[model samples]
Target: MNNVALITGASRGIGHHLARHFYDLGYTLILIARHAPALEAFAATRDPARITTLAVDLSNTATAEPLLRQVLSDHARIDVLVNAAGIFRPGSTQTPVDDFSTLLATNVTAIHLLCQLCTPWLLKSAQGRIFNLASISGVQPFGSIASYAASKHALVGYSRSIARELGAQGIKVTTLCPDVVNTDMAEGSGLAADEMLSTEDICRAVDFVMSLSPAAIVEQLTIGRQPRPRQPR
Candidate 1:
């Protein structure tokens, strides 16, 4: 049987590209996102038998368990799980409490819940891989995106802790920290698109991680662009 991969945020950005990459590698796919129509549309472009789409807001704790249970019921096993659904907002110390709460809910809490719910299915697979989409901000402080950075940092810590706990079970958990990608989220951060990494670049990293042998594991993979030459003064 083909390996099965369930990717959150599969409707767009890095997750969308990863979906295509995995499909090209012949894996059965379960695409999840908040937008049902968009997920359905993307899945329609692929072989219907190999693709499944679920419209879910991962941040909704109450719905996440039921949704994951349904996925396990429909598919025999899930070899890979990608937690790529995230949100970012420009903020400073003075940012509203609600803004910070929203970021934590979507970026950190949702990832935690999904990992908890999916661990069992992942353990059942012979070669299970869990990829959490973190950001460089998770490792470094970014004043402009304070809340986002904090949430990502939390995700990074959680990922590493779980990796250690699950390693014995043959489940490889990796936290992917990319500096800046040319996605809607990056564009919203007011960064120059030309200087950011492409979605394909991120997907390539995913491909590499997924290709590793069962005995090998990458706990953290950080990808960044080269520094541009300084302009003559």
Candidate 2:
């Protein structure tokens, strides 16, 4: 059987692009998104036999595991798990409690839940991989996006801890921290389209990580644009 890849946030942006990339690489894909119709709509473009789509609200942490279990019924093993589903709310520490809760639930909690759920299946595969999409904010806090940054920082820490925990089992965990990819999420973040990295850049980084031998492990990979030349004002 082809290697199985389970990806969350598969309906659009980075997730959507990764889904397509993996499909091209001949991996069987289990795509999950919040909306069934949108998820299925993308799945329709791929070979039906190799694709499985599920609608899951990552923010609903309590229900995620059960929903994931239900969908994995067909696949005996998951070679890769990509935690790409995330929420970004712009605000400082003063951001409302509800927004903070929502960001934490979706960004950090859901990733933790899915990692636990997929560990067994991943262990069964010879080349197991887990890729977590974090951000530059994960490593350094920004005043404007305090809550979002906090959650991402948590994710980065969690991912590194698990990388050490699962390393002996031969499962590689990598957290990708990119600076503003040109996705819908970054549209209004006060950055021009040309300034952000493309989805292709993200996929290429993933490909590089996957290409390494089991002996090599990358705990975190940070991708960012080079500093633009300062226009003399």
TM-score winner among the candidates?
A: 2
What is candidate 1's lDDT per residue for 5-61, written digit by digit as tens? 989998888888888888998999999899898888887787999998889888887
Model 1 residue pairs with clashes: none
lDDT of each: 0.88, 0.91
Highest lDDT, which number?
2
Off by over 4 Å in 2: none
Q: Distance from true position, residue 118, model 2, in Å?
A: 0.2
Determine the C-alpha RMSD for candidate 1 after optimal superposition of all C-alphas: 1.3
Residue 190, model 2, lDDT: 76
Q: Relative to the unseen true structure, what is the C-alpha lDDT of residue 189 in candidate 1, on a scale of 0 to 100?
A: 54
Q: Estimate the overall C-alpha local distance difference test score of candidate 2.
A: 0.91
| Residue range 110-223, candidate 2, lDDT tens digits | 999899989999999999999999999999879889999999999999999999998888899999999999999987877787788999999999999988876889999999
